[model samples]
Target: MAITDAGVMYGLLAVGAGLATGLAGIGAGVGEQGIGAAVVGVVAEEPGFLGKGLFLMLLPETLIIFGLAVSLILMFAWTPFAAFMQ
Candidate 1:
């Protein structure tokens, strides 16, 4: 069957959403890699420093959350997706 305009639009939207989330995750992972090694060394040397190390390690995770928010907004609040709902 031939694809309609809405189908094409929806496909593009899905790809955009996937890329947003995937890229964000990759960015966070890249950021965490270095922080993780440093945090491990700091914790090993001084257990009391674990709290600060943990906080630093978790900072990159916000990127993923923001990405998820963007993807959700694109899927649910974008004009084309809303139009298809009705």
Candidate 2:
């Protein structure tokens, strides 16, 4: 069997979305690592920093959000949803 051009295009898009999400997740993990360490240290020094520490830790989630958006766009670019949104 032979793969069609449409299949090849979709395959590439899938790869792109996968890469975006995977890399973003990895970046988020790396970001959280430093923030986590700092938050732990800060909390150890002053428990009052709990709210601030948690807030900072959550900031890394933005990376994952962006990745998810890219993934969604890639996955839906050819779908009817695109037309519906316009």
Candidate 3:
């Protein structure tokens, strides 16, 4: 069967969703790299600072979570996709 307009639109939406999640994960990884190294150095010097270092390291993870949320919204809740579904 030939591809319809809706199919093309849905494919683009899927690509957008994938990009959102992938880019967010990449950004988080890049952000965590620097913080991870610093955290390692701090924990090496002061074992007592481990908790604080861990908290700081985890902060970058929120970016990934936000990206996931956006992708979910795009796939399931965006008005165009919702309309296309009906």
Candidate 4:
């Protein structure tokens, strides 16, 4: 009895990739949402601080970008278990 490995490794990798992206997006979304809300609140009180608010709002986006880069690298460039399974 031989196990068909055609989809096993690929499926696992896909699931992992999905999880990585989902978690990263969730975290980034929450962080950026909070930042944006805070910036809005600050701006409401002091319209002159627009530059500072914009900077604060954008800072959390770096995490999402980094996560996307890591996911892309994992999906395309490297797969440790793929070698072992094959």
Against the true structure, whose TM-score is highest?
A: 1
Sort by TM-score, best first: what order? 1, 3, 2, 4
lDDT of 2: 0.86
Clashing pairs in 4: none
Candidate 4: lDDT over CA atoms?
Answer: 0.76
Backbone clashes for every candidate come to: 0, 0, 0, 0
Instruction: List the global CA lDDT of all models.
Output: 0.93, 0.86, 0.94, 0.76
Least accurate stretch of 10 residues (summed lDDT) in model 3? Answer: 1-10
For 1-86, candidate 3 gives per-residue lDDT tens digits of 66668999899899999999999999999999999999999999999999999999989999999889999999999998999988
**Model 3 alpha-carbon drift over 4 Å, by segment:** 1-4
lDDT of 4 by residue, 18-79 (tens): 77777888888899998898889989999998998998887777777777776776677675
Tens digits of per-residue lDDT for model 2 on 49-86? 99999999989989899998999888887574355436
lDDT-superior candidate, 1 or 3: 3
lDDT for each residue of candidate 1 in 8-74, tens digit (9 for 90 to 100): 8888888999999999999999999999999999899999999999999999999999999889988
Instruction: Indicate the residue-level lDDT of 75 in model 4.
Output: 70
TM-score, model 2 to reference: 0.80
Candidate 2 residues lying further than 4 Å off, grouped into runs, are 1-4, 78-86
